[model samples]
Target: MGDYDDDTAFLGQTGPYFWTTFFLLNTVFVSTGFNGFYIVFIGASPEHRCLIPEVNLTAAWREAIIPVMSADGRQALSQCRRYKLDVIRNLSEQGLAPGRDVNLTGLEQEGCLDGWSYSKDIYQANIVTEWDLVCDDQWKVPFASSTLFVGYLLGSLISGQLSDRFGRKKIVFISLAAQCVSTIWQSFSQSWRMFCITFLFVGASQISLYISAFVLGTEMFTKTLRVVFTTLGAFLFYCIGYMMLPWIAYGIREWRTLLAVLSATTVVYIPLWWFIPESPRWLITQGRMAEAEAIVRDAARRNGVETPLVIFRRPELQTLHPGKTYTMLDVLRSKNLRCITLMCLVLWMAINVGYFGLSLNTSNLSGNPFMNCFLSAIIEVPAYVMSTWLLKKCARRTLLSTFLVIGGGVLLLIQFIPAHLEYVALALEMAGKFGFTMAFSIVYIYTAEIYPTVLRNVGMGMCSSAARIGSITAPYVIYLGTYDKVLPYILMGSLTIASSVVNFFLPETLNRDLPETLDQMQECQGLCSGPKKKKCVENGGSGHPAKQHEAKSDTA
Candidate 1:
């Protein structure tokens, strides 16, 4: 029945041991961002048109032979179709003026028979150019993006259980290796199917590494630094990796070369396996008392703190859980746990869908795609910093609701902006991105805090699995831009607003001790003792509201 916090108090919460582990943990965090959004560059569609065969035709003849089609409500030359080749050749041979003499508009148009030509302006190569994933095959692009998230969904389910069953440090290295290998292999893919298969592995490694790092950090740090670690430590570095992608893509225009470089760079992290240590909390949970004690003693030595052997000799601390096993059932069977899990699942899905939807939509913004992505990633830095600050000062529920509403409202407003004011639309969209990024950062920490240590990884993983569902749908949401530019924003905005309202029903987690067991969590009875729980105290039973109030004050 003893808490690990008591033992942690002796190790000194902040010290050389902690900082060293934090540094190593963040190395993996940085890599996660690199591959996380590479899909942006790899799947980007460059300007393209049907290839014109060289048949000694004059430029005017070539122009008249290509059919015109409407794209985004504007007339443009068709990318997938052209005039019949024999007709064009005959017209060229006859020297007939196409539209004036021959009435070229009446000629039969056909799909690209000679393949397509891509503009090498922004990207020289990507999956789209390589596979000709345009026109009739356009659906494959979104499906490819969705494949990566499919891997994320699968990985999220298993990583937590594996890490908990094995060790966080081991799973971290394993996933990093998988990600690196899969990324390199993906670059060499000869076909779209091969790329998608490799991407599945890449996606799996991405979420697994993230959860491993997140759970490891959670178990290692005390409550105060935990907020910083989740928001600024893990997430800020992820943004840095994201910001680097456009530059990487800019320098290495070829997808294979770009992927090779990114994958090879991760070799630098292989040595980290030897340096980082397993979590002592996890060690203790497994009844490995001697091993946990040794790590704690070493940490004490590094931190210049002295600890008597008697501290570890306490029977309760030594055998806190001799053979306790927690499963997903523990989370589902209880009323409070079930409510919180369901709410968190919804919150995670909304945050992820909106966040990824806005993030991947950078190409559709008014500015250059590279600069747009760069700025999008840059904006997250301040958003995460503010989120970290707010996590300490604001109630979790309050921040979640407020940020979601602001983000959703901004997205909703973007639809009404005049088309001529593209810059204004972009600015509003960026503001919405900022709001969602803040919410994104908060939700990770919030969800982690809501679950007990035993179920923390599983809980976060399940929530992350829900997030993958949002992510899988995100590309389709962005794909909706092909039909109606503003539709994605409207859909994401409405979902965000609905989720924000649902967030109000969630319990605030600020300044509370994390429950270590399902029973301890059930006892707390769902946000019944927080600063905002005054109404609950008045009612004295499970805090069923007498009246649903819109806003409530919270004291720190």
Candidate 2:
């Protein structure tokens, strides 16, 4: 009923908080639409002609799940051993007939007409050629999966900087529409080369929407709901994907078809491109004071503040706060920042390693790939709801560390559980999922909170880049487990524990101000880096609170 003052007619501009929330929720969900579909696609994307029955040929989708070196001696699946198919195919012109040869690798139509067999590699690839990879050792499955992350890692690095330089709203439209259109092309890809190119573009474009949304939210909202709302945006992203992809996967078994359906949701997000606001903070940072003032006044008028246009010049930069600005070097110049950066990098690594590592091994989670995926995913809904609640009541640092420790503890404990406790291990994995999920959700907010505004995006982006490094490594981590399935968890649990231990030394940030200047950061009490005050005889943190806490403490 109130008069809206957005002259540009931005969609989410000057609306009730719910509409803004709805806007952000849709933004985050669409940004991640490609995730689960990519997972299912990677497994089937290399299948023979994207054939349904040909899904049985790839290491990822093949029915006879066995380790690289070991298979049951008497089992008919002696033909199912990994990497055995390529050895026979080089036999060339001396082709073995289906009726006469023992296919150590499967003959196409194994359960079908018996005499119709050919070289298992050619046969697997021949009938079904569209989406599945024939893993007769002719291709590397882990590397295939790893390539996508390679693309994701590369894409995330520059997407943020690109999004910031361009308008957030403009880039969002470009990335979303481009990715949706690219995905449609993916369904028609005839070769792995084409699939990789399309996936790379999808990964690059999709990654742009997220941090832009986060930055936009931070700038628009009041401090009251900032953390909760920002974190909630991230939480819904995974929760929705977790809830939707598996059900959709079961309904649409063909990976290409499923991707088409998944991409269709993003088409809804296309129209949203015209509506979201240009981040006011970005405008302020770019010295567009006139525009920044306009947006702020528009929101204030809507909120009934009727505030005046104000300009805050840098008095400190002119003389008062000498040596206050930070560069990337400042991140490592102090022992405190160095350790903080390293520890955070490790924590990011462990979470990525564990999350994607376990996730990539979807085949081993259970026999019914679809159901197992569904349960693993659906669990995130309740877990995310609980995380949101805990973030509100609990100290952010404590909650983060506790989740990491618990998630890691469960992973370590799972290794020793007896076979009768398969359910227990699965439960542990889900527990770790919750733990890791909580950790992942908080870290984005946490990282954003901890870094000074000047370095905030770059710092988070670099840290996220490190996280992507772990993402790249994750496929191999889980892939190696195909050689010995338990090894992946052992390594992941160790990494997670190491990450938790690292968190112990990190500066506790509860009820703290976000730092505005180096002096403010250096003077901040009990900062995670090093206890400057504590170093004065009895080591203890003592400094001014970060800028984020300044308004709060004064009121308190």
Largest lDDT belongs to which candidate?
Answer: 1
TM-score to true structure, per model:
0.92, 0.76
lDDT agreement with native, every candidate: 0.82, 0.57
Tens digits of per-residue lDDT for model 2, 1-556: 0011122223233356434644554455534744633564235322121112332243333332222233322233322233223333332224543324544345332212111122332112321233233434324556656666666666567766665566556665676676677677777777767776776666666565566566556545544455656565565765566667766666565656766777787766645654566765555445565776666566555555445434334343232222233345767776655666676788787888887776666656644565666666676666667777776667666887888888778888877877566677787888887788778887777776666544555566567777878977887787665566578888888888878766666665554444433444432223443446454212112134323244344324
Off by over 4 Å in 2: 1-22, 33-37, 41-76, 81-135, 309-337, 517-519, 522-556
How many residue pairs clash per model?
0, 32
Scored against the true structure, residue 244 in model 2 reaches a CA lDDT of: 70
lDDT of 1 by residue, 125-236 (tens): 8899999998899989889999999999999999988988898889999998999999999988999999999999999998999999888998888766789899999999
Model 2 is weakest, by summed lDDT over 10 consecutive residues, at: 1-10
